[model samples]
Target: MTSPSSPSSSSDAEIVVVDLFAGAGGLSTGIAQACEALGGTLGEDVRLVAINHSEDAIATHEQNHPWAEHYHAKIEELHPPDVVDPGAVTLLAGGPSCTHHSNARGGKPIREQERASAWHVLHWIQQLRPEQLLIENVPEFRSWSRVIDGEATNDGAIYQQWIQTLQALGYTIIRDDRGRYGVTLRACDYGDPTSRRRLFVIGSRTHKPTAPEPTHSADPEDDLREYRTAATIIDWSDRGESIWARSRPLAKNTMQRIAEGIRRHCDDRLAPYADVVETLGPEDVEQLQDDVVPIDDLETAVKERTEPFLVTGEVAIADGGVTGEEPDPGAVLVMGQHSGAYPRDAQGRPVPTVTTTGAIHHIAVDAFVKPRNLPQRGVHSNATYDPGAQPAHTITARNHDGHLVSPYLIVYNGQSDAADVDEPLPTVRTKARHALIEPDLFPWGLDIRYRLLEPHETKQAQGFPADYEICGDTKRSVRKQIGNAVPVNLARALGAHILSWNTPSLSTFGGGVTADPETEIPAYAEVSSTDD
Candidate 1:
């Protein structure tokens, strides 16, 4: 075993980081950017050593960070260096796969092997005894229980054991007032457009690093800047025209369901306003043309003038102009309600939590008539939004599936601003595809077009640089890499905190002031001796 009293050299000023389970280098990118922002050289001031089991993820990481030394292998297979130099490694960081601890998995039996993967950090820590250790995962990781021989141990036993083990190794685990060992952070608080809440366990051998302060906020009264919206990161003018994968056609059954759903919704909306419409005059009806018409008055006009005159049958085109058709009472035109599928508002609030399934927007009917020839293109459970105001939802790996519901923002009649439409973008997922509703395409209601988000857009939504390369052979592989990654801005903020706390100029050998070793009791010993 290496002694903790190893002498430090001039080169020790540099912050050396080891990233385990590094997925596409999101964490590394943030750390590197943070180092540079703090007036440090990328390769010299902070060196990175990354390891991952997936070859594709490693390839992506390498493409983005060419200077870092990367290993494409499982953590169990790699042996830590035997020669341990105390204070040589500034930080050891990584998040194990969260499959077993994720709430989204629906209480599936925990995979003991995967849960045990966290032990790899202990193994490396034992070998290197780094100054600081950072672990990121879902919130449930703190309550992880041990499973031995397929039998579950005490609840939170694994987490307790980990804390105890770190304490025994001469490290102080940072905790909150509730004695919680990890700090939960939201990506939006750090100026990332996506709202991803993740737990971070920061342990120090000497000084306790301060928790990262939020630089952005959802509340308007706070001094901090408002969270970045989806519109800020995404290039609306691009429209993904060059990318063929952006739009997909919905299946016949899915379209029929959406059509029926819209019809029912319209009936509900128009029912209340039918009686009030009879009392309105021509001048009162003309008020509907104004953008700021009252909701009550608009409802009356829509039910009286719009609902009563529904077009039916095939639409005729004369020199690319649409010809009006007579009303068909038998064909019901329906508009979809705000079903909360694609939740958004015009105030540019932070997006909701991103899941493996993308956000789904409700499909609404623009007109109340069934056209003879309907466009055969639309997505299932997809969401439509006002493109200018809402931010993109959280991007997830499952976005590759077309059947899943996702958000779709509509740009109506060449109108660029969607601020008038109130709503926020729902979370982005890998499988949820989006559907675009075009009223002019179909004689009845609106024509819906479906498509998946482009890889670049997904990267942007996750706070990655727009020019960042997503190195994967297929879009699915790329989506998976992006989805599993930590938001770049959040990681950068944490890294900056670590760097600020460990600056040699500001403190002594251990970075900041540390608790005296002689006065402390072993956390593990105390817990072990306690009775239930």
Candidate 2:
């Protein structure tokens, strides 16, 4: 935050930016990168003011964007005039809280309590009157509505009215009505390694705003750079708990999913097609050939297939329930949490958009080790997370829903792609990714080793720079910040696009009125919180 009153802050700075509902500096980082791309040193030439209601989020953002001024309060409480010079901010940007309009809420109508967060941006725009405004949200935000004048309006009335109000304030709304990504875009197109999509709305008071072009693509014919893959970003060295020696053991379905994931993903010649049945639900198994053998056949088959030595809850007797002190040698092959029906994803592909639930989604690994005495890493402080069942929102990193555990997983075991019940699939990232081990290459007694993706790997997948510090006392806190972030590469692309429209065409472009000598344009009504 550059104080206009401070002589050294921004008296001669090139740009001033304000981020409302700024979550962990995703947008700010990208904006700073955009500034650098445009040949400006961030600390000297640009000043960023970040505001958010979450104290932890504010701390995280401040730590990462150290040069920026941060406010740990809601946007509505801060008077724009007191925070920054009205005319100094060339760009005003932020994604309002999308909790109300997310598709996850289903068709529930937004109550009064849920509407004010998004509407607050209009007030800031009126007060700050920046040359440009950029807003981000989930696609369902367009369907928002409110009760106006004692009569319920259409489903999208609130958004329509908001847009009209923006137009009234002499701002040009930049939109893309056609194409694959009208206003919503996939982050992988901008070099993010995940397959997350977001909606962006850009407005300009002076120049015409355009969408950022894609930098990477899935199709080679497009001539764009290839998408960054999960394999490239993941730290292979950080495999978490070994399947062989977990303090607690894997769930029945989870072990089954790993068996299939290793069989299919590792390019093993004799893949685990029959092994998949061992992990499948009754529905899937019932559909299989009647000749398919039951668990009774697993032990004899294991001796021949060189496959995973699964120790599930129901099938523990197959492996004699394990060694008294540790897993029997030559027992475990690969282990992973069940994320989706696919179970395993190719390493050379971007992961799905990261989420705040660092807990519920278990980390996975596929490795085989010789039975030599290798020292084990101490259990992580955050390992207290219960692998038992919990609500979806609890693990989703909301302020107060979960068991306060850092990272956990909702292990979905079964043969079907969507074997789990009611959980949103972990974006596009595969569930149990590859950790190859050829049994023939190793002597008999071997260890099974594997781990989940570390916080840093998840952060990088979301496009945050490696050195950027996420401030929080706990792993859950750090995950909350990362999950809530906009992709940095996507943000940078948008920033560059907005910056390209730097020249303000001051002649009232929104409603075709002129600022200098044309017909007078009436001022937009200041919407009160009561109206929200």
Q: Which predicted model would earn the best lDDT?
A: 1
> Lowest-lDDT window of 10 residues in candidate 1?
413-422
CA lDDT of every candidate: 0.52, 0.50
What are the C-alpha RMSDs, in order, of all predicted structures?
Answer: 14.0, 13.8
Off by over 4 Å in 1: 1-13, 82-86, 148-154, 233-394, 400-445, 502-532
Candidate 1 displacement at residue 426 in angstroms: 5.3
- Per-residue CA lDDT of candidate 2, range 429-529, in tens? 21221121212101112123434444565566667889888777887777777666787888899988887665434243333433312213232222234
TM-score of each: 0.64, 0.64
Cα lDDT over the full model 2? 0.50
For candidate 1, what is the lDDT? 0.52
